[model samples]
Target: MASSSAPSSAASTAETFPAGTPAAAQIFTTVLSQGPLTRLELARRAGLSAAAVTKAVRPLIEAGYLVEDADTEARPALGRPANLVRVDGGRALFLGLKLTGDQVFGVLTDLRCRTLLARHAPLSDRVPKAVLASTAEMVRELLTEADGYGVRVVGLGIAVSGDVDRAEGVVRYSPFLEWREVPLAELATAVTGLPATVDNDVRALTVAEQWFGAGVGLSDFAVVTVGAGVGCGLVVHGEVVAGAHGVAGEIGHVTVDPNGPPCHCGNRGCVEAIAADPAILARIREAGGAEADSIDEAVALARAGDAHAREAYSRAGEAIGRGIATVANLLGPERVVISGEGLAAYDLFADQIRSAFAAAAFGSAARCELETRPLPFEEWARGAAATAIQSFITEPNRP
Candidate 1:
């Protein structure tokens, strides 16, 4: 018997973005990020003439990718001088998933990267096949949610930790997942029947920050993540720097202590060894003799006036600070945004972090602004979705 409602299916006819001309995509992106502008302002911002902006906007407006409304308040007495134009965020949909050791997080977002709904599924296994199965299931659930918006889901993005080759759509190596050389994009496309984009989780999040969050309008900035892992994402000249080998920003691997502790990467006293959650937990257990099974327990112990626990966090903070100083010295970014799961304990050692950074930073590098933000876990998923939107705009669809 039929129930009160019907079930939603994952089957979707992937649609192509209608903006074919370079100028059209450029104009659409301008509206997507900084929009509701008159043709004059849009032309100025997009570096095009009024005639060119009008030419590029016609197709997008006809295809529903853009909408124009008369500025009733700003109207001149002569005629509808210049109307305001903006993107229709509800025009399309996407799915972004982030893979962790124990969980797979998924988010459904609109064309403008707005998170409409989110879902979490347990990753019981780390094998490529198992992870793919879990990912496909999550995608199906998100697709069902997308049915509510009555839009076709056009693209999929998967963000993984460790070395990922976005152009090649392969995860070269993921330490946490124990995955190596996984052709993630091809396999995922086969499973879910949507064009897929694969990227490093941190780099993908850096893209989101550059466009919609902290890094907006800054051509030079760095994103440092702490907690489960210490990762850095760099942006220079209005683009995320992925390095020649696609492993550019491995700040956590910087050697801070020559003889402090051994790292999983076979290095001694790498920043991650001292600052990552596992490292801090180990320090609390071994040196402090505290039975702190997780970072939360360690944080609680420190807050409860445990000197040993406090010392562990301080050491982690010092390592992180030194790492940031290295980034500043090398690239001279204007701002550094520090985030990640580890920041939940910022109050424990914020002073130590700032002190170490100040002492190590050199010359004008010391003037760089350090901003601390704690993004909700779901934002990572949205970042993955943003990458899909990026691929849609920059590159054509692939099976």
Candidate 2:
């Protein structure tokens, strides 16, 4: 099941999810993800009886979260045409924020997790206090824009890159921000006056993909993001695994080359130590004795046919491929999605990634499909909103 917290205080006055049982959450999620479904079709997809589906959907429809309409497109040939059911996207609004070391990205979304507006601000400081201030300002901007929609923004989700405890609304550690044990959700709620959820950025992105993007309908899959970090999010048996300690998919820290460069995690040759942007840049500088200030510069050098730069990217790809192979060999996911800002340099190392994976993967694991998707920062912010939507609907009412 998706990890979520109870609705925040800001949602107290808003119309809460009427049905609190897990069955109702499941039924509503089915319609939200794959909807306009007939009651029979919904029951079949959700693995629930027709009566259970009806029972679960009643309160949701009455609360205006789900709506029914005539099946004009595919009316039944039999007696009465079945009505199609879908989530009412405009019923409520949410806010999502993606926190990076140097910038903060935000998006406003409705109940269906559609990005209605996006805004971003630069971060001059990584201090938790400064970040909270920036987040509050960003929230204010989004809320101001949301005012035009005539809907209340009920919850806020903050996606940070590192270990996050979503249920507790805390940032256990965010390497990019150099933060440790930051009670981000509570602080964000205090500053922004909205309920908050905190989650790992890549995992949050996986939620968006699982519900609305590439991973939709896939029972078992992985989302491997390559950029400042090489992060993975695993969905096993149709549920995103948070693991026992909330660090299930730290594929970045997986050892790919024991003798390779050191990582911030104080390890040698971890995937992130080689495949991450900083690592790639470090490699370019070390190999060519040229200071490539940014990833763009490194990509440009490779694109211009610089041997050292191209070789650095190739090595990164190889490390990434090996890491992916490990995930496949262990979990045998049906598909592995390669995404993130690093995809901008994919052309430089695409072949190496493919060949390395092909060589390292064992037997049936090699059958796991590999595909690349380039999702922008705003899309990641929208993912934060998806978490808020999940929290709002799935969390049981508090005593």
Candidate 3:
């Protein structure tokens, strides 16, 4: 299910995106990402003719997607002030959901992918049916919230981990959820009464990072997330690499140690096998049965100088560092943004990660900037909203 499926009879009547030329979308995106610019600057950044930018901006402005304001600073240089065009963030709203093993994170965002409100619910089960039921309830609540803003909720985006075929809206397989060939977008749309996009969770976050966060203005970058799972998302040549098979930048499965540990993907010595939360816990238990019921307790144990707990985190950090090295060597991205839940224990293994990454990185690839940005689960949901905004503007007729 890589393509949008037609809504069933139970679907709600959703509004359609405004019609515009292809350049209109690009022009709007340029403004959306690096906006509030003069037409000349917009054209320069978007690689379009000034006339083309003007032509594209008109329809978007009329449709309320773009708005122009006089540039007060440009007035003195010119007899008339130049107008700056930008995305009108309040024109529409979107819904984004990040589904995790134990929780469902939901957020409402506007055109700029700013979170208006967020909600989370515990998941008692990971079955497709249960997930859909929870998602529908969250969507309904967000829709009610959208009423106060008086803008249509344009689309919905759901982010899940593992092999997801975004073009088909299918989950080829998700080990976290134990899902197989699930037509998630179709089912999600049916339940929520809106067009839906299903994507790999990390890739969804990469979208947010690319447009609104650390990745802005960079043509090539990578996002490596560590937590329950080690996941990677890459942008090369200004486009997210989904690979020909919709699987790419899977640094978690990168073989850091051939003799390490068993991965959930049935591979040995994979980075995720050693660095993910479960893997760390297993390693901790193996040493002294510290009996840590949660990551927090495990963190506390390590902070308190428990050699066993500290060693578990050190190994996990080394694995993560090597994984980051692999990405740098292979792609030479401008930067690597490290985030996710695991950063909570950053102090425990920050040195190990940096040292391992530095020792393993090949030559100038070592110059690749590595930075950590602690992100809450709500931000991941906002990433989902970014994908929904993307679909709304670019694939309005997806179904």
Candidate 1: residue pairs that collide = none
What TM-score does model 1 achieve against the real structure? 0.93
Clashing pairs in 3: 1-168, 1-169, 2-167, 2-168, 2-169, 3-167, 3-168
Off by over 4 Å in 2: 1-14, 396-399
How do the residues 101-133 of candidate 1 rate in per-residue lDDT, one tens digit apiece? Answer: 989999999988989999998998999988988
Candidate 3 Cα outliers beyond 4 Å, as residue runs: 1-14
* lDDT value, residue 392 of candidate 3: 85
The alpha-carbon lDDT assigned to residue 167 of candidate 2 equals: 85
State residue 94's C-alpha deviation in candidate 1, in Å.
0.6
Residue 64 Cα positional deviation in candidate 1, in Å, after optimal superposition: 1.0
Candidate 3: lDDT of 222?
99
Q: Candidate 2 overall Cα lDDT vs. reference?
A: 0.88
Q: Global CA lDDT of candidate 3, please?
A: 0.88
> In every candidate, how many clashes are there?
0, 0, 7
> What C-alpha lDDT do the candidate models reach, one value each?
0.87, 0.88, 0.88
